[model samples]
Target: MKLLLLTALTMAAFAANSVLNRAAVGEAGMDALAFGVIRLASGAAALAVIVAWQRRGFAMGGVGRFVAVAGLLAYIFGFSVAYRGLDAGLGALLLFGVVQVTMFGGAVMAREAVPLARWVGAAVALAGLVWLLWPRGAVKMPVGGAVAMCIAGLGWGVYSLQGRLESDATQATAMNFMLAAPVAAVVWFLWGAEGAVTGVGLALAVVSGVITSGLGYALWYAILPTLGAARAGVAQLSVPVIAMAGGMVFLGEPVTGRFVGAAVLVIAGVLISMLGAQVWAGRVGFTKSSSGS
Candidate 1:
């Protein structure tokens, strides 16, 4: 029960990233690179305080640290770049599709046993995503935006997998922010001035950093041990749905029929992929034991 709650909260946090990013960059006319740098810098500062209070020193000792840093860079850059051309909902769907593919592919590469049910679920979800985002009559896509969304998906998938390899979530998250901050700053220095950076932009970055990205991620790390990979992935699939709903309610974005259908498919697919195997294994064990008894 605790794990379920934690996972749900984590998904909400992740979902907010999309909504907030859209609001900041799309509505406010803020530069994406500036937002990314400010968001990450604020998060890094906040985490630094927390880690210092806890007496944790920075450490990047092994391959995990390298992977974490790389994942962070990809996620930050991919996120900022993707929004340049993609609409919020469409971007979310695209990113989710890429994320699902990346993580599942990672699992296969790691030689983790794949169940047939999961494969089917993945296919179902991918098909749903395609339906939701594919350009229809009159809805021509910005190719650059689509490309950015795919990159973001790949980056986030790597980040999620890297979290599993970290010995300490808080520590790793803090270090990643600290390490990535410099990179973000450099990128911003190169490109930030091109876009007018307003008070609204900085405020959005701060809010995202302090609330959604920083503390949210720390909490996610804390719960990862309890939830494991399958449950975690399934839980994250809720994020895009939540973000879409939030957009409708708060941002006044139009809710469409296709989005609803896509949400249903993604949610159902995630549940099947994550929970089916465990339930099947449990039933099999129970039957064998009962027959022996």
Candidate 2:
């Protein structure tokens, strides 16, 4: 139950990132690049303080750290770029679809044992996602924006895959932010729309960085090892649903019948992916024991 709650919280945090970006960059006229940079810097600062208290003194290292940092930077920048043109729902869909593919592919490459139920669940959830956010008539997609979201999805997938390798989730997340924050800030100052940064945007970015992103990511890292690859990928298929629901609740967006239906499908898929495998294993074990007896 605790793990379940933690996983749900992490997904909400992920969803909140989309909400914050929409509120700040999409509506408040905050430069996307500036929000991304501030988010990274603020997250880094918050985590650094935690690390200091732990007295870990920044021991992050090796190939895992390198991959983690690269993936983090890619996700942060690509997310900002994509959100500029894409609506919050569309952006979330693109980000998680690519993430599912990336992680499932990683599972294959690494020879991880993914159950059949998980694959079916992923497909069902993906179908629901497509149904919900596939865009209606006269909707024009900005190719660059869509492509940027794919990059963000890919980056997040890579980052998540590396998370299970970390010994200290907080310190590892801190180091990732610490290493990438400066680069993000540098790029922002060099070419970002400085004047476009608004006070509301700044506050949103800080909240996103310190709470949703910084702490959220730490919680995610802490849970990845326990989830395994296939389940983790399938689980994230819920983000778009969660994000859309967040919109209805916080942004006063009207929900439709379609939203309710799609939410059910997504939730059902998540349940099957997570629990079906365990049920199957249990049945198999029971049969083996009975035969032995």
Best by lDDT: 2
Tens-digit per-residue lDDT, 133-205, candidate 2: 8777776678999999999999999999999788789999999999999988777778745548899999999
- TM-score of decoy 2: 0.93
Scored against the true structure, residue 193 in model 2 reaches a CA lDDT of 50
Please give the range of 10 consecutive residues that has the lowest summed lDDT in model 2: 284-293
Estimate the overall C-alpha local distance difference test score of candidate 1: 0.75
**True-structure lDDT of candidate 2:** 0.85
Q: How far is each candidate from the true structure, as Cα RMSD in Å? A: 3.8, 3.4
The backbone clash count of each candidate, in order, is: 0, 0
> In candidate 1, which residue ranges exceed 4 Å CA deviation?
87-90, 138-146, 225-234, 285-293
